[model samples]
Target: MTKLMIVEDDEKIRDELRLFFERYGYVVACATQFDHVVDEVLSAKPDILLLDINLPYYDGFYICRSIRKQSKMGIIIVTSRNAEMDELMSMNLGADDFVTKPFNTQILLARVASLAGRVRQDGVQTSVLNYGNFSLDANKMLLICGERSCELSKNEYRIAACLLRERGKIVTREQLMDDLWNNHQFLDDNTLTVNVNRLRRKMSEIHAEPSIQTKRGVGYRL
Candidate 1:
């Protein structure tokens, strides 16, 4: 069964959603304390997250960004904010999907199921890899942080994925260049630097600094 985490603060809505999802064969865990949301999320390690924009203490975006630091799980923002900017911002923050308030329960269920399926399919190779506020999907080349996600280009994905897989461990620059380029022996060093910068920018977009710390004389580490 797919496990889901519900991060809504409204007691009535949370209960309804929990009951509704449970009926759909999902194992649902609803947040009881806003302050401990992160701890709860890490412990639950849910397959998908149902987030409300208006959360207690810290807003949903902060929580999403925080989780994005180390999880590639599906994230769906179900909120009352209906503005286009709100939707855009949610996506930018790392949400896989956005459903406004007063949504159809069936539709919400369907979206959750769809996302859950994708996450499961991709889970085969992407068992785990963590960055600051982002996680890399080794199989899908997907960069996820909170409600925002960015699809990585082949080289970009490989480089970032490599760093994340060996997070906290150094990966030499030469090794990274070779891994990313494969048989391409003529790839420029400057080109590698450029790709790294672009990947760094993408990571920073969702509030995660590049966990890719340079060793100056060595390589990079997440």
Candidate 2:
């Protein structure tokens, strides 16, 4: 099922859209905090975004450009601003489409469906996990910190991917082992330790600060 995120600040419109999309079998997430729109959207990892131009802190144009820098997710500018310049600006900032306020619900749904299809067709890999100043490209097995990037070994990539996906949260040693060895068999603890140390060293080579922290008896957190 496609996941959709609504970034409108109006509570009424946000709720209505959430319910409408939920009824249609789309997994929906609404932005509760306007200040960190990009972080919220990235954390949700939605397939499409229904964004409003008038927002607190930063406008939708700024948010769209910021997201575009790291992701190619579908963005539809749903705003009250009907100016031609607004639409053109949205397109220039990588928005897939623009729909003015008081839009036809059916037409909006159709646009989202169409854009989602195109995004999938393009095979745009937007599964990057951003933690602090680092972005982990799981698909390419690359750990990117600013302009520097280091390729990861298969085991190192899997471990880093897991930790970054659950950034700031504890990923249990048992869970890490399970992810490393998919057959349900336990691997030596020292092997997992070695792989993690190697990933840390690679991260240091690129000057990625605040290295992965170990939770000792628990697990690890990035």
Candidate 3:
């Protein structure tokens, strides 16, 4: 079943959304705490996130940016802030879509369904990827090797996922950066190198076999 997470502070609206989405057959999870909204959403590992802009501790923009750093989960900003700049900022922070306040529940449902469909089309709906002895848990951001396991950060998980998808084939640096940042023009090459190094360290800690191999100027291989 497709999972949905809601991060709205308004109790009445949150309950309404949860109930409405559940009626549509979605396994819904609601945020009970506002200060750790990002962690809450990540833990839920929902297929789609319905986020509100005016959160309690941190705004939705901050939450969106934090979530984008680790996962490419679909995020739709459902907020009362209807200004054009607000929408633009939400998109800039990696929100998949934006819906204004007083939104029609049906419309919200349609948007969630559309975003979830896009995620499926991207071939990321699966929660796990198995490569040889390694099992990458997309939901938990964990890489398991036999009995030992190591948790991965969002960037590390993406890098591992990309490499594992192609297995022994070479994955160029440019391809990795594009995959990680969604072709953000301002991204630095060093960031990709750092993430790859971190991933290598994690894999090593678990003694994962068929280690990530650097192909010098060409790219990396597993």
Candidate 4:
């Protein structure tokens, strides 16, 4: 089920939205504590946020910035203030969409559906991985160093994707095993080691500075 958080202060509007969306088969939550919007958001870990620009203490923009810092969750500004500047500012603050007050509930729901679908669909359409003068296409798993293109194997690509997603953070071997094999039988340690070595060799060809780094007993990072 898609989880949604409504961060508006008006009790009537909040309850209305909660009931309406819930009727449409969505798991809906409304914010009761205005002061702890960020805390509520993190705790809920909602898939999409319906936020109001005007609020007590900090406004939606502040909450939006805070959310972006920690997560890539979808944000939609559903506010009474409908100025062009407001829309632009909301986008700048990382909102996925904007819906003015007195909106058609059907249209708003449709927009939410479309945005959610896009977010889910975008997981595989990887952007180019660029570090220094080297770059690689993550979805196609093609590495480019200057004019050179290096091909990566299936296992190599999976490992690279995992490392690239975490980037500078350590990705434990257990995590890699889960990612590569789901919940299937355990893969041989030698198999993983061989794939990592192959990945490193390909990365070297692309002049990937630092390539993949091993943290001894910890894991790997890039």
Top-TM-score candidate index: 3
**Winner by TM-score between candidate 4 and candidate 2:** 2
Weakest 10 consecutive residues, lDDT, candidate 4? Answer: 117-126
lDDT of 4 at 142: 80
Q: Write the per-residue lDDT of candidate 4 for residues 146-181, one digit (tens) a residue.
A: 677788877777777677556557899878878889
List model 1 lDDT by residue over 10-72, tens digit each: 899999999987764567898999888877887888888999989878888888888777788
Q: How many steric overlaps does candidate 2 have?
A: 0
lDDT of 1: 0.76
Relative to the unseen true structure, what is the C-alpha lDDT of residue 153 in candidate 4, on a scale of 0 to 100? 74
Q: Against the hidden reference, what TM-scores do the models get?
A: 0.55, 0.55, 0.56, 0.55
By lDDT, the better pick of 1 and 3 is 3
Cα-based lDDT for every prediction: 0.76, 0.82, 0.82, 0.76
Q: Which residue pairs come into collision in candidate 3? A: none
Please state the error at residue 13 of candidate 1 in Å.
0.7
* Model 3 C-alpha lDDT per residue in residues 7-106, reported as the tens digit of each score: 9999999999998887655778999789878888888788888999888899999999999888888889999999999999999999999999899986
lDDT of 1 at 6: 94
